[model samples]
Target: METLFDSACRYMSDSELIYEITNNKKLVTEAERQGGEYDLNGLFSSLTPGRKKVATAAIELYKRLQSRHNGQDAIRCSQDIDALIHPFLWDLPNEELWVIALNTAAKVIKKVRVSVGGISRTAVDVRLIMRILVEASATQFAVVHNHPSGSKHPSREDENVTERLKKAGTLFDICMIDHIIIAGDTYYSFADEGRL
Candidate 1:
């Protein structure tokens, strides 16, 4: 019977082994030698299980350091909006309503999934969306949902919901910036079309 170390060696390359252990593919190649082979059994046996914990701690520390200098602020235009939401909705088969709460600076504070429904439609709870905005201390928000049918045009229900949310947002001094419908790689924005 093959040992776990032997199996790992047979199944994974040096870079893959390092990535499995470190979860950092960027560290796979070094200046000295590209993906230089190491003694897998020796490496595993000599180290404590705490190596993974150490790596996790290091990653967390790095993220904290980067956040201080990161410019993860508000959207500047339709392109920014597309970049923010397309990844989440592009491949979904059913409809999902995502409400993004934004601060006074228009920076995203939180993204809440108001509802998820059938292939064509998902219910949007205005109260829940408003509650999320209030809880996040958001001054504005944008609504996004996917059309698995590959049509970017808004349905009658979509227009009605947008109107209702606009009214509710105005009442609470919160602005509804846009209603975006995404289908595959394309998107339609109500604000850009002068609907919002």
Candidate 2:
């Protein structure tokens, strides 16, 4: 049987197919940045039946990459946490809250995008954080957010959120590993400074 890609390619001019594939590749690069399960249903709905098959294949590929842990699942330090999350924060112009769920071994189970907002701030509800932790059965978690302003210092709000999460995590028997403020290539760790 012809593959989904082959079916879709039959309907597109060579140039149109090439252009669409290129754009999908760009989307794949930014998949984890979505901060949640990347939903491609809407994108597929907009295409012709044949094209939808192609989009589905692309979406499946993206999902596999987002979940692929390789041998790097265990987070060894703040730097390891930074390396895991940095790709998802790339080129993000606005603020976004990301939660990394971990097993007892410090191996990442998933990365969740809790919220996204204006350039200056993104609101995070501890309840939502709790929900994800419970769902993932995560024994430990780390929080990371970016500042487009290129300053990695934790703001008053960042400290407040860290404290709140720490208190809440304590109640759930879930340890909050660290709260990281990422700016460009640099990062500040709450745990590193004895803040968490």
Candidate 3:
């Protein structure tokens, strides 16, 4: 199968420019390794401002194509959540928490980025999360956050937040499905581990 880089190159108007942009070994390796989740900054850092603009548009188009191809399928398992969410959280230098609101049948209703924080930690506001769930009319939801330090282990604070959210969801008859900690391609899912 042709790699994603090769496929992306075919869409570029100038093959030579794409070749020059992708000339760096690190860029090529990372792009090939991560598929749609590769680092945008690293990909464009060496390019001129004009080239960066072209590259940014190309990347945005690529992401749209990828998401369209993937579709918004039901979340059946932790792996499904990982595949659905990796593109959003991957390549970030800091942490971000997102909520995936699901309908009664488990199909995604919406994805909301709840918070963005420094390298190690981000605060989660339960009230804000509850408000979003209520507004979306979601019957079930999963919370996901990235670990920029590349560890999948949940901290004590992560556990506390998960417990609190689970309790809060009970009051509204909404379900807290899982808490996923993503680090690059790997992830830890509380539901999968019997922690939820």
Candidate 4:
């Protein structure tokens, strides 16, 4: 019976294997000694040389990109829901629903995973979605859930969820622009289909 902790450790171990470019075996050995609790730098220290600089550069580049969007006034971004989902929904497994919360301007303030259910059809409760949106103080939102079937078409359940969320968003004064279903490299958007 592997616990969640074990699963996380497994993911960490796999990451090490995938990114083992540096010969910083000392870092790996230390992390191994400590049962795999290495800080970002400590983990990076164990990488082989080329990967170290590459990884570090990647991080710095990401930081710069994040800085462009980090902590900005929400009133400026009013991004159409399709714009956000199109960039990230592809290739995700089904039963994983992610929400993009936005400020008044429709700019994304946060991306949250509100649920992890079955790979086929997960039960989606509207209240759970509402709760997170409210907690985040988001004024608008776009929802994206993967299908795992590699079909970007929305099912009846997906349509229902979108309608329900739209109605619910009205109550919170949060606009629900679109609900996207992503599978493999394809994606479907409710708004683009004139459903929203």
TM-score of each: 0.65, 0.66, 0.79, 0.58
Top TM-score prediction, candidate number: 3
What C-alpha lDDT values do all the predictions have? Answer: 0.79, 0.80, 0.84, 0.69
What overall lDDT, based on C-alpha atoms, would model 2 receive against the true structure? Answer: 0.80
Best by lDDT: 3
Residue pairs with colliding backbones in model 4 are 21-48, 22-47, 22-48, 23-48, 78-105, 78-106, 91-184
Compose the digit string of candidate 2's lDDT tens values, residues 91-151: 4799988999999999998888899988989999999999999999999999999998888
What's the residue-level lDDT of 130 in candidate 3? Answer: 95
Cα RMSDs, all models: 11.1, 9.4, 6.0, 12.1
Q: What ranges in model 3 sit over 4 Å off?
A: 1-17, 20-43, 68-71
Off by over 4 Å in 1: 1-71
Question: In model 2, where do residues sit more than 4 Å from their true spots?
Answer: 1-71
In Å, residue 167's CA in model 2 sits off its true spot by 0.2
- RMSD (Cα, Å) of model 3: 6.0
lDDT of 1 by residue, 79-155 (tens): 66666777667778999998888888988787767888889999888988888888898898999999999999999
User: lDDT of candidate 4 vs native?
Assistant: 0.69
TM-score-superior candidate, 1 or 3: 3
Q: What TM value does model 2 have?
A: 0.66
